[model samples]
Target: MTHPRPPRSVLSRLRSQLVVSVQADDGSPLRDSRIIAALARAAEVGGAAGLRVRSAGDVRAVRAVSALPLIGLTKTWRTDTEVYITPTPGEARELAELGCELVAFDATRRPRPHPVAEMVAAIQGSGALALADVSTLAEAEAAMADGADVVSTALSGYTPNSPRQEEPDFELMRALTAAGIPFFAEGRLRTPAEAARALDLGAHAVVVGSAITRPDDITRWFAAALRDAAERTVSPVTEAL
Candidate 1:
């Protein structure tokens, strides 16, 4: 069976647009749902076409505040598996029930409790599209084959088979495009330039997280860059002396 497309409204909203993923890590002060809603509203004001949010509470909050398409997902760590991004069909169903236009789930080769097809069915049955968060080209192929409406490069750096890079996985994006697979560019997309470049590379859309919503992560990025620059300058001056 062919993968079912998202609602035309959702697809039209996201085409060549930015989907800001407003996720705060476990210990972040911004982990609260209120802060996530505020970030979603800010992204809306900043012209984000959609929101990719974690957890049902965050989804509800964001939905309450913004009218944009929402892609919901859950990150649950379990002892049995490394496939944590919306691992189960139940989780996918819950996110869809929370008003998610699409639900993202791990579509990697890792051992998963619920088969990819089952999860996709659950999302579809709930009236939401299934977005496969894939790590490799093969995974992307499998996800589409298993009826994922769309695939995303969200798992690139997280999976062992995928390249570990500080930059966005444009190589994976290109590969997906060459294979004629529809996909969204995500993971390590830290700048407007990179996001734009992803679209130029034929991404259906781009999803940016941490770089936009997580203030702590953004602060660290700037701090690390400045520290590296300072060190480089100091080393050169010391050598000259």
Candidate 2:
């Protein structure tokens, strides 16, 4: 089937800008669609060039409140396969039909229910650009070859084969840049400086998630740091002894 080509203007709007991922973890108090919509509006007010939203319900909610370009996906856990992000073509089509400018899907080498080309076609066929979330350079290359419009370093640390680290996958970004693959810098980018650094490293755009929207995770990070610092404090009594 000949699909309507995804508009190039949507990509132009995202270049060198921040795309806040406004998703709440399962069971979080902020999981409500109303709260997600509010957070999306806040991100827009803060000048986010776009938004990366999860789930069809949240996408509809955010779409209702904001006009920024949306990169949409569904994080459904299937016992049959580990590829959760928009694992099915039906899910990808739904996101595009719901008005997402781009649809993101897991593009890793892990066994999946569907082929990468099929997923890309689904997104493009529904009139949205395909954003392949990849863990390694090989996956990005494969996804591009499979007709993905762009790739993101969103799954770099999540996959077992990729480097596991506390910080964002700068190494993967560098590899992508060196190989001349267009990609978005995502995953564990915690600060504005890091986001700026991503732009400096040849990323098409930067996608920030937990640092901007997951308040519970942010609070835990701070709490853990404080606890470690308190443990390391050298008391005067100890010094004297």
Candidate 3:
């Protein structure tokens, strides 16, 4: 059976644009779908061209609140494997059925219940493009071969095999570009300059999350910076004492 091509309007609309990831952690105060919807609306008003939302309920909430393109995903933990992002075909299919334009799934080399190709086929069968969340160039290549429509640099630092970095993984972006793989710059993109730099490094687009949606994370970033500054400015005599 053949599936129709993903909506071109969505794909074209997201090109060279900012896709905000509005996700609240497990214990976050703003974990409710209503809050997420408000955040999505705020992002749209603030010029975000698209949204990368987690959970089917969140996707539906965001979709109801904005006309922006939506990329949906689910984070599930399993003791058997490390591939938590959309780990199963059922999750991918459900997200697609929620009217998301794209469904993001883990396309890494980690152990998973379903093959990456099966997940991709499931998303396409539901009329959504499959965006592969990859950590390495090899994973990206494999995802493409497995029929992923797009690759995102989402799992680079999360995976044990990929380099752990405080900043965006420009090396991975460069490698993907060199391999002629178009990808979305996603992980650790904390600033406008960093996002722009990713685009300059050949990212198809950029997705910003904690920096934009998680106020707690942003507050911590500021607090850490202030602490570092205070430590750096401390007097030599005080340090000696």
Candidate 4:
């Protein structure tokens, strides 16, 4: 059966803008939807292409504030497994209700046992598109088989075979791009330099977090820099004396 192409907003269709993931954690975004909304608006005003939000409340808040379409993901976990992002059709369905234009999920091969194909159908069924948050070529290939509308290199360094190294995994991106899959480069992208590199490597877009959104991480980065600078050895003996 043919599914309607998922609704794409003007902002979502653009490829050059930044997609900042507002970490909708329980501690911050969860506790304060206002902050999430404000940031979403700021991001929108700041020329964000889209927002990758975790919770439904955060999604609603952002949607109400800005016209920026959302990529929704629910943190569905079982028995110590840290499977954030929709792991089941049920979770995807729930996210769609919250105005998620494109629902994001972990499309890895770790036996979610949720019938990946069924999840895709459910996403289409719920009137939302699907984005596979994958790591390697294997996972990306599998996600296509399961009908993922888009594939992302979000977990490159976090998964086992997906090396935990820097760089945008250009080899995998090239492979996916060769296969006609749109690539979104994510994971440990801490600088604008890396963002440029990902685009050069043919990524359709890039999602940056912590480095842009999470102020706590920024605070720590500056603090650590200061500490490092303070600890530097004194190398001035013949200056003005």
The lDDT values for all models are 0.91, 0.94, 0.91, 0.77
Q: Rank by TM-score, descending?
A: 2, 3, 1, 4
Residue-wise lDDT of candidate 2 within 1-241, one digit each (tens)? 4457667889998999999999998999999999999999999999999999999999999999998999999999999999999999999999998889999999999999999999999999988999999999999999999999999999998998899999988988999999999999999999999999999999999999999999999999999998898699978987798
lDDT of 4 by residue, 1-241 (tens): 3345455553358476678888745566335778878877778788888888877777887888877768888775687454556877888887876778788888876656476788888887887888888888888888888787778898777777787665567677778877877778777778999887787777888888778788877788899988897688545773445
TM-score of each: 0.93, 0.96, 0.94, 0.86
Clashes of each: 0, 0, 0, 0
lDDT of the structure predicted as candidate 2: 0.94
Point to the candidate with the largest TM-score.
2
Compose the digit string of candidate 3's lDDT tens values, residues 1-241: 3456567677777888999999998899989999999999999999999999999889888888898888999999999998899999889888887888889999999888899999999999988999999999999999999888889999999888899879889999999999999799999999899999999998888999999999999999999998999888988896899
The C-alpha local distance difference test score for the whole of candidate 4 amounts to 0.77
Q: List the residue pairs that clash in candidate 3.
A: none
Q: Which lDDT value does model 3 have at 117?
A: 92
Q: What is candidate 2's CA lDDT for residue 9?
A: 86
